[model samples]
Target: MRRQKKTILLASPRGFCAGVERAIEIVERALQKFGPPVYVRHEIVHNKFVVNELAKKGAIFVDELDEVPKGATVIFSAHGVSKSIKEQAKIQNMFAIDATCPLVTKVHNEASRHHRKGRHTLLIGHAGHPEVEGTMGQVPEGTMTLIETLSDARNFNPPISDGLAFATQTTLSVDDTSEIISILQHRFPEITGPSGEDICYATTNRQNAVKKLAAKTEYFIIVGADNSSNSKRLVEVALKFGAKNAVLIPDANSLKLNELRNVSVVSISSGASVPDILIDEVLKKLDQEFDISIKIESSIKEDVYFNLPPILRTR
Candidate 1:
């Protein structure tokens, strides 16, 4: 019996965005400089593999500031955290390092700036997401409103419509967010928005790459954690762009080979938070079961880099 032949289209700019790299490096460097048992406020990133690897290196992941012992160095996750969390850390006197992505920080700053200018801010993002929580928390409780869908945007009636502004989550689907934004802007023509889009370049670039690959592939697999917002968006983008089938797999281990049995050409892309090694593992597994030919499909080349947190710089 002959092995089935398959073509794998690999999306570039697919894994480990600069923000994630910095966040992981922050934990590693903190562990090295301060030694083991360093506390991190949340999973440094959404990926369990990355968190587990950091754990082995002596990082302790916790849910809140109260869980951390007094005076212990606690790092914020890449998702950012509330201003109250910072106040609580200060009250507890815990040495704190913020590993929030610079892109996320930008949204926080936008919210704060909008509030200072007396504008009622609207945050466009999924509810309960860490970044959304943090961004919304930047201003007074009632100053910002959360708009997760087009319906929310359409129904939102700001206390003062003339003084409206909006910010967004960095990891949202570009197309979906645009639709929501369009609805809001059409309703409130005077509403102000960020100078540039709130979604980071990494999220936009990865989606673009996947969209190109999805058009030519019979099936698509997105390698990322279930909790990763950007990863879920990739699956939706692929399916929306014409891929016959699309699924999200945390890693190669999660893949159901049967789904690909009839797929002559499959496209693979990883979320911004995923590591390249996971994608390599998936490729290796496919090679063992089928005659595989890999092709690189990239819509753009990303040259973005974010520096490690300043405190880690001295070490």
Candidate 2:
């Protein structure tokens, strides 16, 4: 009797979005240019493996700006930063490098534009997320409100005009965000919006690929840290798309054999911050545990590259 082969479908445009790439490059270049003890305001990106690797190279991660010594080089996380954070950096006389994703910075600029135009803004994103916090901080505390659900949109009242505009976190659920945006538009028909979708192309492509592959896959696995919103979204999208079992394990060590007990087809993807090396590790473990075959189901090809900051431009 021949054993049945388990098929694994790999999603393309899965790991390391453009923003994450830029953020990581910023840190690496800073290390090369300035040498060791370079301070980072937050995890440059959320993946544990990336953070640990950078830490090994003397990149110091701190939650607060005060932790950074005067004159030390501090790099902001890809999620952007609050106005107060930039002010504090200046006050402390620290040399700062912003690694905030360009897409996120666009939303921040939109928030400021809306506030300047005397229009109250509704920020659609998860609360307490660094991106959300940083975007909301673009304006005064009372100038904008955070809306996480349709209910928030339903009850939200703008202090200024009904002709409101909105922005979102670069990493968010494409489907869920659309529904929330619909609710906002239904409530305020005069609401203004940006010409382009707020979520980055990499995030959308990954989720779409997961959604397409999950239906045919018995089990779905996402390689990313627990703190990664985009990584978590991939798991949720997979589950929603009909995968019997879906999980987000940081790496191979976190995978459980039981999850694959009856699973004959597996789909895999990684978050924006996650590195391909982690995915490769998981693949190696899967190869040892099961008779697996590989398939590539790519939704789109990604060729986006963000330029390094001016300081590292020559490098």
Candidate 3:
């Protein structure tokens, strides 16, 4: 008997957002310019495959600045970093290159500005996430409070209600963040927010793409790392929007063969940090098991790009 046929809704605007592209390229370029053993402060963009590939090319990923020798080169991850981290690097006289997503840098700046004006900031994201930590640290200790859920949004009594502001991680569930923002805004009518959404363009685009196919898709597979906030949000969005089931797998081979047994229509999307080759492996795996018809369901077109750091150009 012939293998069963399946239809795949391949989400466009998925994988390798401009920031991730820039981050990975920064690593590769740094290696080229400096030769082997250049230090990177963290996993460049949270993708294991990307990290492994870079590691092979002489990028040394360390958890902290101390791991890098004094006055040696180091690159910050795309998630951005705290003022303390930057200051530490400066103190150590390390030649640091910032690979932070400019979008994330924007949030940091916005939160800091709120502090300069004396408004206590409610950072809307999970605590301890590098991005959230960096944003929280932009202002002094008591100036920024993290709001991770509806309860956090509801119960926190600000030092004073008069001055209030909010900023969010670039990677988050759009619907969930909106609800949290609504709760906070409703409670604090005068609260200030970004002139536009803090959630980055790639994140919003990927979530919207998943939403467009969730109802018709029987199963959804989000190709992204477990620690990747935006990728996990894609899984949640698929399940909430109407897909029968959804999961986040880091790679093609990590997908369970059993999960595909009953699904005739599937949707696949990747997080902003994912590389296209991972998605390709998933397609190849799917093709081996079934006669798959793939369609590109692009909710939007993304033409964004971020340039490599200037230090990469310096001798």
Pairs that collide in candidate 3 are none
Go through the candidates in order and give each one's C-alpha lDDT.
0.91, 0.89, 0.91
- Report, for all candidates in order, the number of backbone clashes: 0, 0, 0
Report the number of the highest-TM-score candidate: 1
Could you tell me how far off, in angstroms, the CA of residue 123 lies in candidate 3 after the best superposition? Answer: 0.3
Question: What lDDT score is found at residue 216 in candidate 3?
Answer: 98
Per-residue lDDT for 1-315 in model 2, tens only?
A: 444468999998799999998999899999999999999988999988888899999899999998999988999999999899999999999999999999889898999999888888888899988999999889998888888987888888778755588888888999999988988888888888876459989889999999998878888999888889999999999999998888999999999976686778988999989888998999998888788899888889999988888999875
Q: Model 1: clashing residue pairs?
A: none
Residue 106 alpha-carbon offset, candidate 3, angstroms:
0.4
Once fitted onto the true fold, the runs of candidate 1 whose alpha carbons sit more than 4 angstroms away are: none
Q: How would you order the candidates by lDDT, starting with the best?
A: 1, 3, 2
Q: Write the per-residue lDDT of candidate 3 for residues 1-315, one digit (tens) a residue.
A: 698789999998899899999888888888888887889987888899999999998999999888899989899999999999999999999988899999999999998899999999999999778888888878889998889999999998999758999999999898899999999889998999986559999999999999999999998999999999999999999999999999899998898978898789999999999989999999999999999999999888889988777877564
lDDT of 1 by residue, 198-306 (tens): 9999999999999888878898999999899999999999999999999999988888888889889999999988988899999999999899999998788888889
Best of the candidates, lDDT: 1
What's the true lDDT of residue 261 in model 3?
87
Instruction: Assess every candidate by TM-score.
Output: 0.98, 0.97, 0.97
TM-score of 1: 0.98
